[model samples]
Target: MENKHPYSELGYKIFFKIKPFLKKILRIKVVGVENIPLEGGCIIAANHRSHFDPPVINIVSPRPVIFLAKKELFEVPVLGWFIKKAGTIPVRRDSRDTAVIKKSISLLKEGFVIGIFPEGSRARPGEFRKPQPGVGYLIEKAKVPVIPVLIEGTDKVLPVNSKFPKLFKYNIDVIVGKPIKFEGISSYEHIAEKVMHEIRKLKGERHG
Candidate 1:
């Protein structure tokens, strides 16, 4: 399956225009953004806590990022238009969507950055969910660097069951961890664990 909506100049243009407003409203503080490579295909594995996660990454990232969103989001009214224009790929959860996999591979090979929430679903505050294996599979298959990202306070900004964000009421932090290379790693689950471990460290959580 070919990617119908690849990364576009328009997306970046729109993002740059709205970035300042978003940062002010969310009080977003980004750290370790320099850890992101200047050029290359890489996977950003992040912990999901709120819908704001994707926008935070897009605004803070040094490069353009394409994320795999659930198929349902693409059916919405205005959101569907924006996500599609931003080059988001629609994925069917809990199943092997061959089209998504193929499209991801194609984008990676073309030196595009991909963002993935390994948790597979948003977790509540003070909760940690085990990561799904799909991110690991992509890491192993893409054979690219994986950067672990930790997002904090988005849950408070826009928690589950809430439509509008509190806006300027909370501070959000996006911490980017060092990239992990999967050159000789063979186990997808192990690689996924390692990625999650880094995210935990960024969140100041202990992991053994």
Candidate 2:
């Protein structure tokens, strides 16, 4: 991936280096990692909660996961640099950014794993938000396998607008849902709904 910034990826390197510090604060237990592809272009569509979601996914997945972070987040000088270095794409939510789309597609073709938060935006108190359908489009267009990841207990660890994660060692479980068949899928909506169902079923209890 071509990143314009020198420090865009610095965060990833630094984050990984200091992750041991987080170990004491967070009890992150990931399961079914074998469900993810060892290599090749595969999509990881997961639920969004804390800022830690992307980092957590990268830590456990054997393959490198390219996260589609919001474009604005990368605008900051240092933050932008590291985001690009981490191979994350900047997406413009309201309007389609051709540059970002092209870059993401290119990365997938290169056999790199891509991560997307299908919820589009963070979840609220009401019903779960519907996916933007872009992921389904990518799934069919890229013709790659889709892996649904259900993240439970992240919100409890750190809710929206909370600067620091709770000090307590909360149980954060990640469930890698089975890869669903993509051959017969004709529409993006169909596939989007399918992925949501898989995540819902895979969401487990906070503990145990």
Candidate 3:
């Protein structure tokens, strides 16, 4: 079957080429990977703590997952170029831009995996931010299953204010929860809150 995702084959090719190196450097351990559906549209909602979060998820996912990045990141030099070529969707943080949302919904309908950070931006280590309503809105509109994920130790790999990422010494763990399909009518904020609740449950289990 023809791939419906907007990302070029070259992106996946490049990823395959370097995935081994990334796996070795990041030392990522994955759990509940089977929770991820083998095919069809779904949202991989995870907490954000580092710029490496997106790549880390992509490295572990069975299918290519596209992410939404801040519009400002696209203007950066090398990082911006790489993300753009990787087919990330840029979203304006300050204003209400429907284009990005529409594009995301379209992608979901196309049966592609879309990755999102409910908190919207990176938080300090051990800190949890309230999720933005955008993720909830997307779920309501797209009516797709959401795979809640919990990621740990990425912040240590690239702590805030550090110019470069640590090549080693940090072990990253990603826990993928069961897919959730919301059925009732609810506000976007409520949906986002519910998703975050699921993510937190994963954290609680990890520590319990």
Clash pairs, candidate 1, are none
* Count of backbone clashes, every candidate in sequence: 0, 7, 0
Specify the highest-TM-score model's number: 3
- lDDT computed for candidate 3: 0.88
| Cα lDDT listed for each candidate | 0.85, 0.76, 0.88
Give lDDT tens digits, candidate 3, residues 60-133. 88888989999999889999988877779999999877999899999988899999999999988978799998
Off by over 4 Å in 2: 1-24, 76-78, 125-127, 204-208
- Model 3 misplacement above 4 A: 1-4, 206-208
Kindly give the stretch of ten consecutive residues in candidate 1 with the minimal lDDT sum: 1-10
RMSD, every candidate, angstroms = 3.5, 3.4, 2.3
Give the 10-residue window scoring lowest on summed lDDT in candidate 2: 3-12
TM-score ranking of the models: 3, 1, 2
